[model samples]
Target chain A: MQKQWLWAALAWAFAQSAAATPTGDVNAQLAEMQARITQLQAAYEARIAALEEKLAAATAPAAASAAAVPAATLPAPSRGGGAGAFNPEVSLILQGAYQHKKKVAERQLSGFWTPGDAHADSHAHGGDRRGFNLDHTELVLAANIDSTFRGQATLALLDDQVELEEAWFQTLGLGQGLGLKAGRFFSGIGYLNEQHPHQWDFYDQPLMYKALFGAHSYTQDGVQLKWVAPTDVFVELGVEAGRGQNFPATEQDHNGAGSRALFARIGDDWGVAHSWRVGVSHLRTTARDRERHMESELIGEHAVAAFSGKSRIWLADFVYKWAPNGNPKDRNFKFQAEYFRRQEDGRLAAADEQGLALGESGYATRQSGYYLQGVYQFTPHWRAGLRYDRLQSGRQDLGSNPAALQTVDYRPRRATAMVDYSFSEYSRLRLQLARDRSMQGLTDHQVTLQYIMSLGSHGAHKF
Target chain B: MRRFWLVCLMLVLSAPVLAGVKVLATVPEWGALAREIGGARVDVFIATHALQDPHRIEARPALIARARAARLLIATGADLEVGWLPILLRESGNPHIQPGQPGYLEAARYVVLRDVPQQVDRAMGDVHPDGDPHFHLDPRNIPPVARALAARLMQVDPDGSATYQANLDAFLLRWQAALRRWEAEGARLAGLPVLQVHRAFGYLFHWLGMQSRGELEPKPGIEPTSGHLARIVERQRAAPARLIVRAAYQSDAAARWVAERAGIPLVVLPYTVGGSPDAGDLFGLFDATLARLQGALR
Candidate 1:
C-alpha cells in the first residue's frame, strides 16, 4: 500500500513539472522574437536616418547668403512662449530677390553723421561696396490672458528706431455691436495700416502714408475708445481719440477737445453674397501755430510784428471697406477707398515773425486714394490677387520749401499689383510689381518675390 | 412679412419667460459634460460649437445674449477662454453665473496628469505639455467628474439635489460595472499596438491597458505629413498595425494613408459633443468608439 501511494505522488509531481516546461519554452521564444524585432527596428531606423542625412547633404548649396535678411521674415518655433500653441506666435518673413529692371542700377549710398564736431571737419568721406540692408526684424506677441482678456503687441525693424511704429492695449468687451477698447493702438484708419508690422504684403509702406503721416504709418500714443454697434442690418458707429505720437505740433497730442474724432460705418453683411462697409472719420485737432521773432537782446523788449498764434489744422478722412468675410476658402474681394484732407488757418502761411513759415504747409498735401483688390482661390493652399491703387492729389497747399515753389508738380497717380501662393496657414510666397510716381521727380518700377516660412507650433490659422 | 412680425412679438414675449434652466457651457470641453449632467433637466448652450476650434471662437452678438440669460455657466477655466470668453462674459450682464458664483463648474477639478510640464515656454510650440483639460477622456476619472458635476448642479438647482444624487449614483454604478466588463473583454486586447494622430488617447489607453506604438504627427500639435506617415507605415509593415485612430475634425488624410499602406483599419472618433449624434453624449461617445475599435481590430 505504501509503494502504490508513492508511485501516485511521483506521477503527479512529474506531470506538474512537465506542464511548466512549455510555459518556460513559450516565454523564451517570445523573448527571442522581441529581441529580433528590436534589432530590426534599430537597423530600420538607422537606414531612415542615413537617408535623411543624405538628402539634407544634397541640398546645402545656395546663392547670395546675406545676413541682412530681416529676422521678422522667418517664423520661429513659438509654442512654449505664449499662453497656448498659437500664442506668442512668431513669424519671420525673409525676402531676397534679384530684380531685373532696365531703368537704374539700384542706387545705394553709405554715410555717417558726426555730432558736435561740426566745426572741425566739414568733409568726411569714405567709400565701399553698396552692401545689403536688413529692413525688418518684427516681433509679435498675441495672447488671451485667461479668456477674459486678449491682446497683441508688436515691435519692428522697418522704421529703424525713429521712435516710429507703435504699441497699444485693447479692451474688448461690448455687449451690443458696441465694443469698448482704450489704449495706445492704431487709429483704425487705413486697411493694411493697422496690421502687425510683418503682415504687410510687401516690404515697403505706401507713398500716401509716408507723405501724409510720415514713416510711422499714422500711429501715436493716445487713448482711443471704439464702439461697434450690434450686427444689425443697418448702421454701425465707431469712434476713437487721443493723440497719435507723430502728429505735428500744430496738432498737439490732443486737440483742445480731446483730439475728438468721430466715425460712423453702416452696411449689411447679408446681401447677394456681399458685405459692404462705409464710414467717415473726422478729428478736430487743437494745433497751435506760433511765431518766434528776431526781437531781442533786451530781456523786456517784445517784437510784436510777427504773425499771431492761432490753432489750425483740422483733419478728415472718408473711408470705406467692402469685404466678403463669409467665403469657404477666403476667395473674397476687398475694395478700400479713403480720402484724406486737412484744412489750415492763415497763420500756417503768414511767414512767422522768423521769415519762415511756422508750419511746413508747403510740405502739406491733400490726398484721395482707393484700392480695388480681389483674391481668387486656385486651391485651398493657393490664392492669387490683383490690386489697383490710384492716388490723385492737387498741388501742395503751400510750398514750405523752394523746390515746391518751382512749380506745384503733383505726382502722377500710382498703381501696384500682386500675386501670392500660400503653402500653409503659416507660410506663403509672393510675387509683386509696383509702379509708383511721386512729387519729387521719383518714378520707380519695382518687382519683388518674397517667401514667408513659419516653423514649429506657431499655432493655428483659419487659412 | 406679417407672420414674421407676429413671430418677432412672440419671440420677445417668450424669450424672458422660457426661464427653462438657463445654463452656459464654457466650451466644447465641458459643454458635453454639462449636457450629460444636466440630462433633460436643463437647456444647455455651448459657448463654442463643434464646427470651429475652441481656441479661436469669435465674440459675436448671439453669444453675448445667450450668456446674459444663463443661470449656470460651466467653463474649462484653465486659461482656455483667454481669447474671447472674457469679452462675452463681461458683456453678458448676468450676475448669477459670475466666476466665483455657485453656478460655475470648472471641469479640470478631477484630473491627474502625467506630463504636466514643469516649466512652460512658448518656443517649443504652444506647450500645454502641462497635460491640460484633456483629462475628461479617461473612464477611471468619471467618478470624480460626475461627483464634481453633481456638486455644481445641486448649487444651481438645490430642489433637485436628490434626483441629481440618485442619477449620479446610478450612472456611477453603471459606469463602474461597465468598466469591469470592458476590462474583462479588453483583456483580449491587452498590449494592443495602435497608431494615433494625436495624444488624445492617453486616457483611453491608460484605462484599457493598450499601447499606442507611435503617433503620426511630428509633435503634439503639429500636423502630420506624408513623410511621417511613410515612417509609420514602415513600422506597421514590420509588426502588422491593427488600427489607426483619428479625431473627426482632423484631416483623415494621414490616417487613411497609414491604414492603406499598412493594410490596417482606420477608426475615426468624435472628440467633441455634437460632432455626430451617434456619439452625441459622453456615454455614447465611448460606446461608439469601443465598438468601432473592437469590431475592426479585435
Candidate 2:
C-alpha cells in the first residue's frame, strides 16, 4: 500500500508541474503582446511627427508668398501695405448739379456786402446756375507724415478757379488730451462750418451763413489748439489764431495774426437711441482796405468799395440725433440748428466809373440769422430733409450821409425741401426744391438735381 | 506754505494710484476679457456700450480723452470699428496705441476668420476683405485669443508675467470645464438648421454644429430687396428652419418679418457680454446664449 501511495503522489506532482508550464506560457504571450503595442505606438507617433514637420515645411513658403502678394483687387486697402504701399488715402469726390431758376441779371444781397461774393468772375460761386453745372470736384489726400504728425490736403476745382479747401498738419501724441493743428483750415465756428460742402444736409448754404459769412464759410490760414476734458460727458475747448484772408476778414497784408476764434462744445448721450451736442463760438477779426464790388442799377456800372474796420461774429449751434436703439441701419433722425450774430464797425469808400472817389462814409451794421433743419432716414437707403432759414438786420447807421444810401428792407428768408437716395455710403443722388425770398420783392423758385460720387478711399466723417 | 505742501503731498500720494496701465477696449466684451486677465493690475475703459452699434459711434470728446490717456488699445480689428476709431485715434494723439505698436492689440488676429470675400466690391455691400469681424461668439476661439493677449500683456508689462500666466491658466481651467458642460448640453443642437439676420453668428454656429440656412441681408451691409426676401421665404419653406436669430444691436424688423412669414420663433442672442440683461459677464454670456437657444429648441 505504501508503494502505491508514493507513486500516486509523484503522479500528482507531475500533473501540477505540467499545468504550471502552460500558465507561464500564457503570461509570457500576454507580456509580448503589451510590448508590441508600446513599440507600435512609438513608431506611429514618430511617423506622425515627421509628416507634420514635412507638411509645415511644404506650406511655409507658400503661405509666405501668398501673404506677400498684394490684394489690389480689393476696394480701398485701409492699411499701408500691398501694391499701393507708398500711396496715401486718396479720394476724389465729383459733385454735379442741374438747376432751373428764374433769370436774374445780377445776384446780390442788398444790405450785406460780403467778401466771398465780391468776385465777379463767374456764376460758379454765386449759386446753382440755370443748366448742368460742375458744382465742385474735391481731391483729398490724407496721410501720416510721421509718428508725430498727420497731414491732409483738399483741393477743390471749380469752373474757373481752383481753391485749396483745407491743408493742415495735425499733431499726434502731444498728450494731456491736447491737440494742435497748423496750416489753412476751416474754423470750428459752428456745427457746419468745419464740414465740407459734400457733407452738408442741404444743397445750398443757409441764408444766415450767406449773409453773415458770405457765400463760403470761414476758412483761414491758422494754428489751432484744442483741449478735451476728462469727463463722462463730452467737453472740448478750442482756440485758433489765423491770418484773415477769407470772408468776414479781408486783411490784404496780413503779416500778423488778424483773426482769433474761441469755441466750446459739449455733447452727451441721453440713452441708447438719443444723443445731443451744443456749442458756442466767437470770432473776431480786423479788416483793412478790403475790396467789395457792387453793381449800381442807377448808374449802370460796377463800383468798388474799400472798407476798414473790426468784425465780430458769435455763433450758437445745437444738434440732436435719434436712432431706434442706436441701430441706424434701418431708420434715424437728425435735427440741427445754428444761429449767428455779426457786428461790423467800418468805413466804406465808393469809387465811380471814371476811377474817382464818389463818397467815403463811416458805417456800422448789426445782423443776425438762423437756420434749423431736420433730416429723417425713412428707409435703409432713402432720406428726406427740410430746412428753414431766416435773417434779421438788427441796425444800420451811415455816419453822416443819410441820402447816399437808402434804408432797404433786408429781412431775407428761404424754405428748402430735399430727398436723397444713397446707392452706397460712397455715392448719393439728391433732388432739392426751394423757394427763395432772399432778395426783397422777388420770390425765386429753384429746382436742383444733384449727384455725388466718391471714387477712392474716404475716411469716415466725425459727428 | 502749508497749502502748497498739502497740495504737493496730495499730488505725490495720487501718482501711484494713477500709475496703473490704462486700457481702452472698443467693445464691452473686450473690456470684460481685459478685466479678467488684467485683474487689479490694469484699469479698463469700454468705448461703446453693448446696445450701441459698433459700426457707427460719435467722436465724442470723452472718447478722445480716454484714448489720449490709454496706454493700451484693444480692438476687434477687421475694420469693425473703422468708422469712428480711426478718427478717435488720430485725434487722441496717443502714440502708444497707434497701429503697429506693441500697445495695440487686435483680437481678430489670433482666430481663423470666416466669410473672407474673394473680391471686395461695394456692390457686395460693405464686405470686410479681411473676413468677418465677429469671431468672439465661439467659446473655442477664446483660448487662442486669450493666449495671445497674455503674451502681449507679458510683453507690455513684463513685471506682471507670472501673475498674467496664473490668471490665464485659471481662466482656461474654468473655461475648459464650462466648455465641456456646454458641449454636452448642446450636443442635441447639432444638425439643427437656423436663420440669422446678419452673418455675425458664423463662428458660434460653426462651433455649436448648428447649420445656417439663410440670412436676412442679401449682402453683408445691403438691405434685402423684395426679391431676396422672396427667395429666403422660398428656401425656408423647402428646408424649414427651426428659429430665426438676431443680435441685440441689430434691428428686429427684418428678422420679425421673416419669422412671422416662416412660422418660426425669433431669438435675439446676446452678441457680447453686456448685450442682454442676463449676460452680465463672459460666463453669463454663454450661459444666456445656450439657455435662449435651448428654449428656442423646446
Candidate 2 per-residue C-alpha lDDT over A36-77 given as tens digits, one digit per residue, 9 for 90 to 100: 655654565445434433432333111111111111111111
Q: On residues B1-298, what C-alpha lDDT tens digit does candidate 2 reach at each position?
A: 9999999999999885667778899998888888878788888989887767787676655677688778788898988998889988876767778876767878766555678788777777778877888888888777655655665676677777778778877887788799999999889899889999889899889989999997888987777777887788889867989999998888777888888888899999999988899999888889999999999878
Which candidate number has the best lDDT? 2
Candidate 1 chain A has its poorest 10 consecutive residues by lDDT at: A120-129
- Structural similarity to truth (TM-score) of each candidate: 0.62, 0.84
lDDT of 1 by residue, B158-200 (tens): 7666666677667766776877876676666678888887776
User: What ranges in model 2 sit over 4 Å off?
Assistant: A1-81, A116-126, A293-302, B1-8, B15-21, B151-163
Q: What is the C-alpha interface RMSD of model 2? A: 8.5
- Distance from true position, residue A155, model 2, in Å? 2.1
